[model samples]
Target: MANFKKGVALVLAAATAFTFAPVANLAPVTASAAATQIADATDLNLVLGETKSIKIKDISAYSIQNYTVSSSNKNVAYVTTTTTTGAAVSADGATTGASLTFNYSQVGKTFDIYAAGNGTAVITLTANNTNGAVVTETFNVSVNDKIEHISVKKTSDNSELSTAKPLTIASTDIKATPAASIKTNVTATVANRAGTTLKAVSDDPTIVTVANGTGNTFDITPVKIGSTTVTVTDTDAQDKILASYTFAVTVARADETLKVTYDSNRDGKNEDYKADSTNGHSKQGNAVYLDDDKTSFQIVAESALGRKITYTSSNPNAVSVDNNGLVVVSDKVKQETTVQHISADISVKTEATKIGTTTVPAAEVVVPVHFVNKKYTTLSVADAEGNVIAQTVNSPVDLADTNKDSKIDASDDAVITLSTKDKTSVNLVVASNAGDNFVSGEVFAPATNGKIGTTKSDVVTYANGVLTVAKTDITTDTRAFLVLEAKPSTATYGANAKITLQILVTTKNANNVIDVAKTLDLNASTKTATIAAKATYGNILKYELVEADATQADGYKAVAGNSNTDLSVNASTGLVTYKSKNSGSQVVRITGTSNATAVAPKAAYVTVNYSVKKNASDLAVAAKSIILEEGKTAAIGATASTAITYVSSDESVATVAADGTVTAVKAGSAEITVKAASDDKFDEGVVTIPVVVSKKAENTVVPKPAKVTGVKVANVKGAKVKVSFKKVSKAAGY
Candidate 1:
């Protein structure tokens, strides 16, 4: 029993046995020798993208107790279970890469672990029982490395169709070369089909640039039925390559049309139709029209012509012609004015239609010459050759048709009146007859009748025959007659031809008054006749006025020679007359002669040609006004000048010095005047002096020394000067 008890104790202590009692039976007891638990490590490996399953057999005698799991060193997987087993089932955890973790739990449960090579995880199966002892079994699982995926795509949005990869045309096959080390590779081959054509290029290859890259599509078009292939290669830096693609090429027809125009005439056309050549166009805008259709039309807007036209497009695209044959454009244009090279003609008309008809030509014409026959004077006619011809007999005495057109007019008629110096007058008649025809004619001192034409007789005629004067003349040698006529005919006549005539003596009645117009030309200084007028014979008192016409060089004037007339002139009639002949231009009055005398005595010593001065003698002085600007001093040697004394009426208005210097006192006019002293040899005269004192005086002084060292002093008695000098000192030596 003792042995048995010791053995039992040992059994209890050393043997792992269990005892049990049923009901009142024995209670179960299990003696477990403190198990020396053990854990071991199993290593696993997996590839990326590959799943691996690991069966972990419990090599340890004791079950693996619960323990921690870890995959701290790998990027592939996470621990699905921290323990081998529990109320939670053992898990074959989801993993990635080549590795994963499976940890121990209770002693009896199994745990699964998986890895995809790159997935590495560490699991320690720690054995744990009711005993305080614990152990861990570690498992290192990793998945194998693998190639996951391969794909190709454009980096950009790849939207532009023109730059996009080419599409297969008619199933073209193109070949490519790939890198040699690749286990799996893809390649492509492309060929243009016989009839297949590429899509219309959004952009031509010439314009859109293609970048260098692994894969790119180049589009091409083929001409006619042809096949062309392009090879593509994808390679690494070391010439290791991937798949490549090729595109087909096809050529297609493209069509477009354009229209343009040019200027027909470089001269700009105006927009305004009414504008003539004087107005011109300024600008031209050139444009082109593009059309897809083969048919084309053109519309040209010409700024110069201001016109727009539409027409079928010519090769040059300009509007060539209008509907009409007119080469000029129908549109109005501004243009310069010039004779048109057109078919239109021009004609001119005038009121005086014919040049050689009644209107005479400006050219010279021939005229006949004739003379009047008088009783006391022989008459004659002559041709241009100087041959004497008998007078035409009994021509009608119609002076009106002087131009020889058979028309009567006043221009062709000649009229006259007569007067005499002895207050005698006469009446006479004349006509344009066998003696007169030219536009102008001269008169002679005879009538066509057998009587002498006295100073009181006159005759006038034109183209018509003449009428004789019925006058009686005194049988005096001074008796004269007046005859008037024109050129004998409208034939050649000398300009200086003399018309000869004769007349009988005539007597004049002394009681008759005759007045005639005369002309006089006088020399301005002398009032003497340069040319004298014909003398008049008339009762001078009967002539109310003597009128003068200044239009002619020695114009006519009618003057009275009678002494019983007022000394008055009619300014409107340009007439001069007087109450008596003593007041006429030829009348004279007696006046005293003046003698000049010296005033101031000669200076201390001098000689001079001084103006002779006269005393202030009381005489008939004429009141006259004169004008001079301000600051003006007048030197009036004398009123009558020469040897006369002149004094201002009011010496205060202007002062007169002994030297005849008249100085203006103020701003006003003064008269220092006098009439000419009457002398039988000189005409009456008057003088006017005007003095105007302006703002300032302008004086010019001439200096004359009392005695000049080198110059010869002139007029020394009337001039004086003062000399000044600085004191002089003797030189040091002196």
Candidate 2:
């Protein structure tokens, strides 16, 4: 019994030792190691230039005070200075990028992170402890370099379509209007993150097609009138679709400013319309001309979109026109040496009324034709051009605007008006079929009625027809009749043709002013500008370059006949180029003569104040405002001579790349700024482009629970109780 008792006691002691052996070191109860976590980051996948927000929940022993966010590569994954809790602030400082906003210090402080570029980044949310140890939570950001937007530009102008707007090509009736001016090729641009080269494919080749060009540009040729999408993909990414752009080839129509061109050379084409020929297009201001024998010639629109041309005559008794543009002249032209005219009304009819006379073409599609008689006269008094100011008669005292165009032009006869009743002498150049002998002989001075208004006197004496318009015996509104006897020896007249002149002298008239509009800039791309000057009452001012000597080259003298190399003036076109640089301000004088020689007898001047200083040209941008939805992108239309850098004011809202591509992040506003680096030829320029970011139209809906089977109430204490339920798929909140 004693030994049994001892064994029992020993077992009991061993059991006791095992049961309460201080249970201390087996393992401490660790509650699964609670962690400091980011509640929103399951996986950090971001598009380049995109921004996202994260929350760092203060769990376990991690405190919220003195906590800061940082990125490993600020260029790739960047942190912003803005914050909701105002935890920390920085620029492109040691710990943060110069972008984004984050709210810190709260239990779950929000952290705004930006995928500024393409690459991987390690972002850490660190909390400082009293001890040297620290609590840190990290997120690895993966950014995909890809395309975001695609657009087109006119190769001639470099202007781009609006953001999200399709590249539209107006209709071209090419088959019907072969001479139509339409450009089919356009340059395409892809706004990308890492500038990965992309290939473009049109959904329908019959609508449009894309051909890859240099760099990130492509050539898109419109084929027809329809809408097609150009799918852009990264071939290096195994043909992954990056973005898509739309091309809407809209229907073509005739130009608003319709013009009817005369095919004067008896051909069905406008190849004979000389521009200074082969200079380019037809003389945009070509005067009307008709070959008397040039019947059956065509008259059509310089540019038409399947429209018809209709012809009618103002005076069918003088000249008649057919709908097919056939002109017939009648024998009503009695003046052999003088020029005469008959108005012809031409218009474009909407119906493709077969180029023949079946329908009447009227308003809606018509442009009032400004025409003059295309003539080769036997006798005329004109300027350097054959624009006859006065022609020898069989004229019925032609002093009025015969065409009733309100202004004095070539269609009007010459009437000398004196600014004052002073004895002013002038010269006249008579161009006639009469040889030099008849031009100098006693062919002029004789009057048919043998009087100046029933009185005989030398009110105006004629010496050589080239000079001597003597104003010794002149009065107000004086009329003189001078008859010329065309001698057979010198005159090209038929048998006994006589040319008569009805010279009228008038008094001073008010409102004789020349309105001058000139542009003078030395450092402009187009140093030359055609002076837009107008005379009183719409008389076209004739331009001439005045001559200057070598000494007065820069004397601001006229740039004609002179040896001035610093300037050039096109006599034909009043286009003046100011090429002088490093020179101080000088006045360039150009001859501004008026066509109303009777009113403006003396010469006039158009002065351009040429003050040119050589300086660097400033950079420029075409767009004023940029607006887009979240995740949408656009490009800044900035032009510069050197490399450009871009920055966004609020990277959380929008971000711009080095190439001026802008990406919208969240719903907010930002300023995208472009900076052009300074070089020898260009000044450093900075322009701020405003951007408005709108929330995307996408709606995210959480799913409803299928059944509330496990839902129950728990932890009932006082007035509060806890409710528990099974987590449902995609159920966001309780």
Candidate 3:
């Protein structure tokens, strides 16, 4: 194997030697090779803006240096660089602060600038000790703008110290120029102190005012020079006062002083006076003086000294104040307020007159009164004090215990006419303080001077305006008052009315009788009673009666249930017993009477205890039993209550009638039964009666033949009688 391997190696070495011998022969090149020998001829001398490729013949690797590109002069003057191997000018050329920078590597290279848009520039690149050589290049680039934009908003309420809210003033522009000056009203022109004319755009001065204080001076023409209180008011479009100033006018005065007296304590007096010399005070708010040249003084009103400010005036007048420098008005025609400011005097005057007027029409009122039972009731007329000054009384009356105190006496009159004038109409509602003693009615013409005006004849009629009174609801526990109201037309409403009426709610105790009471059991016999009695409220006496009695009592009497059984009652106490029969339930009708006749009939029912005895007769024998043959029949009968029933002991022997009768038909024992009546008394008891039957009988005898008859006899037809008899007849008995 070793010998074979050596031979093969020898053959491989010879083949390799042959393969390289031709390439070494073809290039014959050495270290003295030309540039064109290292790279392609056309690829040599590369342009400044182009890339080039280097190639070698036969040799696989080599190096190049000192490659260059010349510009402007051909003294081999080229873009400078360190001579090295395998370097070249990039497509963008070398970098400069003014242009782009070079970035080169063994295989790749590039150029860049901090920004884009570099102009064309000549540059060079030298290769290192590598096969590739140096090159030259030139390039240009365009740039794009890339600035960042940002925004921010204010944090506060979106306001700055330098900015101001727009201002508006009534009757003028905020420039303080008159509106009429904007048009044809030249005489009313507003001029500035600096010899400038204020321009305005408005036309009507009465409709608007303008502010011109931007320069602190303004002028108004066509006005009298003497001092006059000019009420200048400054307000925003919404009538809100942001700031206001008041000043005096002079021929040359630029600054004006506004004087004010303030009640610091609001005690109805001016405690201080302030002067504003730089600007006028705002009437809409606190007034102040701000002129640097003038001294601001304080003044106090006389009332500030804690002394009562008194004003003397005519009768029927009054005065007051709000304690805030507001003077209380009085009946005085003129009023004055005084104060001291800066060792000087100040006063304000105001005129006063009646606010309105009032008048009272002439009128009268008529009051109506009602009473009942002649039982002393009172009516009264009173002032606002509730005191009865005028009063009258109806005769004796009992108002009943309205308070339930068990007493009914009171002191007053039931009717009265009060005399008064010029009053307001009021309704003194007739309220029953004791029992139902009062009722409501209309009181007409209260404001008329005792002259009852038109009367309402229906509900309340007054012919020719004359007052007439009528009574309503008089019986039972009742009382009333006639409210008279006179409303004055002059007085203010709610204060114009006057109430004066008589409280005729007089009550007195009187005698009365309630009906009597009774009771009964239903088992007792039915019966009735007559009740008759009469009662009166006062002195009147009455009588009554009802008749025909089983029993009589002081207050009632028992009677038959007949036509006259109804009760007739006395005037005092009615006969409070029966007017009806005691039908288990009895009704005792009590007829009440007053003034000798029956008034009202009242009834009460009681029960009566009653019972009934049910007696029934025993079933009676109507007829005796009849004899019959065996084939015939006979019957026994009895009579009893319609409801009685009959039964037979043996139907084969005899049958009984429905009325307790029995019949015999066969020869046997029998019985008759009669039950108690079948009315509701079936539950009482049943009765039964027995019946008998006899049978009739007849006798017969027979004899028989023996041994002689022993002979067989098949047929024997009435031939002969065979007798096995010991016929021993004792002498002539046959």
Candidate 4:
């Protein structure tokens, strides 16, 4: 009994000692030691639609046994494991026997973990070593739906359309004699999102209607003359509203018209007339003419009724009437040498019986007429020197129609060719009958009568007539010069002697009134007397000869060539050259004793002054300063009386070429200089310009944080709650 108790006590004590021994003290046994424990762990981060790879380094002494992966949301994110020798395996926790395995030779190897998809998902990867040491890593993956942009366009014109106010339509267009409608369509474009539909709705269907069309298009139509609103909304497949727009529309009615009435005399008033009981007619004022030929008079057609009227002349040969009641003298009247007066009667008839009624004749109106004789006895032609070349019934003169209208009328230009070659200036002289007086020149119409119908002293030039003034040299000591002067300034006409100046200077500036410095008024007593020699010239002055007054002067008339009114000056030389048609001798003369005499007339001359300066020395620059960016170029524009040379102070900052092209090199300042080239006409000139160059901009990158996929509340307590989330990458700064 004593020996058994001692042995059991020894065994129990030995077993207790073995059980209490520390792990570090018993290291060198058989079998492999526990695989190296994972010393540190790291979570994963991924974006929506992005795949991330996690590399886990194995530091174990033995091969890995297995690795299992699980995900919180399989639809949002899933995991796959890849090894060096085997194909990748999906490890979403739903696959059976899905684990990564390593061989003995693959000890201390690394494995790849992949996570991909959209939305928030937690990926848990549990890895076990051959010795049963386990480690778990969680990865938070986030996926987002990014919307790039949205656009709306009109389907008709494909133009971007927006409205902040109401659009109006006319009721006449929509509700005319037949029903009409206005239609417009629009389309919406959603970018970076899928399965989106656009819908349109109207606030008042009675005023406007909206309907859907093919492929993101909507049509709107007008229904009535009222105001309404149309709303358009964009939505996704899940009925999530993305965008909405509204437009207001209005319809309006047409305008009304006013009443109409006749406005005689154009005085904006109506006049009334009464018919005589005995004569059945009303009398208007008499139509008068100076000669036996026809003449017209205007009669007021005033009435409340706007009706057409008819006109009738008693004698067609004496007078004729038109639809507007304008009576004209007939052209077929025989020319009577004896002075006499004639008469004609005109009547007017209306188509209205009463006011605003178109039935029987309303009334009859009569207009009286009178004519008288103003005849010419003799016609004569004279030259520029006031000498008679031909006379009516004496010279073999021919009356040809100058206008070629197939009729011999007053407008026809006469041709008088004498045996002499002096045909430059000519005039027509008509001697009136002793009792009758000549009317105004305006009364002579080409279609009225065959007479010349002009005064006895009217100037008439033959074909190709010209008038010229010869250049005369005059010297003076004063700086201001008198270029031209009219002599005598006065003249008289008589049977024994006649005095006149054939050529006269009328206007000095033509008709241009803008440039007072360049224009001269010949009618003014004082005028511009000097001009700079080096300044632009030639449109500064103009002159003309009074041909009509010259003919009446009794001494001179205009001839051919330069004597014609169509005269001009040389734009560059400021000189006048008069050319004659038959190249006849140009003469200016005063008349002595009757048509057979001649006298010398006083003349006119133009004078010019010379300047002391020889040339111009002006220098100018267009711009005083300019700003430019780096790497930009500009022209250093400068002007002088002569050519110039350009230079840059600092070529590295801004370089200047020979053609004045300035190029900015970098961010700095420089000076540009321009100097005049050698020239005798102008003095030397120099100009300087400052230039600045700007620096280039620096490039910077800003990362966009990943959008939140989801959020959840946990550990809720009265007023506060704990928030958890699938975190984004730290590099994204969120």
Question: Cα lDDT of model 3 overall?
Answer: 0.28
Tell me the lDDT of model 4 at 727: 82
lDDT of 4 by residue, 80-157 (tens): 555345666565524434544443333344433333443576655444443444444455555432211112222221
- Tell me which of candidates 1 and 4 scores higher on lDDT: 4
Candidates sorted by TM-score, best first? 2, 4, 1, 3
lDDT of 3 by residue, 1-734 (tens): 10111110111111100011111112222342222221121211111122222221223233333222222221211232221343433222242111122211222222212121212322222222233322222222221111111111111221121124321222321111121222111112122222323222212233223344343333233221122111222333555443222322221111112233443222223433322322222122222221111222233233110112222212213223232333222323122222111111123211111111211111111111111111122333443446444332211111121222112122332233211111112222232212222322344322123222333222222222123333222232222233332221221111111223332211222223334344432211222233322333322332333232322322345444322432223324332333343222333343333322222222333222222323344456544444554444444455555566667767878776664445567687766666655443223345555555666555654434332333333444687654443444233332
lDDT of 4: 0.41
The most accurate candidate by TM-score is 2
Candidate with maximal lDDT: 2
Clashing residue pairs in candidate 2, if any? 80-99, 80-100, 82-101, 82-102, 83-102, 84-103, 171-251, 171-252, 546-560, 547-560
Residue-level lDDT of model 1, residues 1-734, one tens digit each, is 00111111111110111111111211122333233322222354432332322334332343322233344443454333223223332222333222223233222332334332344565433333334344333455554322212122222221123233333223332221111111212222223212222222312343122223233333332212122333344333555333333433322111111112322211122111111122221112222111111111222321111111222212111112332211221111112132111111111011111111222111111111111121111123432345433222222222222333212122331122221222233232222232433423333443234233333334322222232333324343122323334444433222222232332222332322222223321222222221111112211121222233443222324445422233333322323332331212322111111112111110111011111122222333232344555556767654442234456666656666655577776666566654455442244555656655555557866444333234343453547744444333432221
- 1-734 in candidate 2: lDDT tens per residue? 10110110111111000011111122222322223343445446554455565655534343222345566777777665444356554433344233332222234545466667657977655443323334445567776432212234222211133234222232222222332223344444444345344566777887556787776555555454445555554333445434444444332322212345553322232432222113322233223334232222345543232222345656566556666655555555433345444444433333221111222122222222222232222345543344444453322122121232123232334443323334233345565554545443222322344332334334455555532335444444444444443332422322322344455444433235666644355443346677666555454455655543433412234544532556666665667776765343333343333343335533345555454433464678887899999999888878877787888999999988877889999998999888888764455788888999998896877666466558889878898989887876765444
> By descending lDDT, how would the candidates be arranged?
2, 4, 1, 3
TM-score computed on alpha carbons, candidate 2: 0.26
| lDDT of every model, 2 decimals | 0.29, 0.46, 0.28, 0.41
Cα displacement (Å) at residue 686, model 1: 99
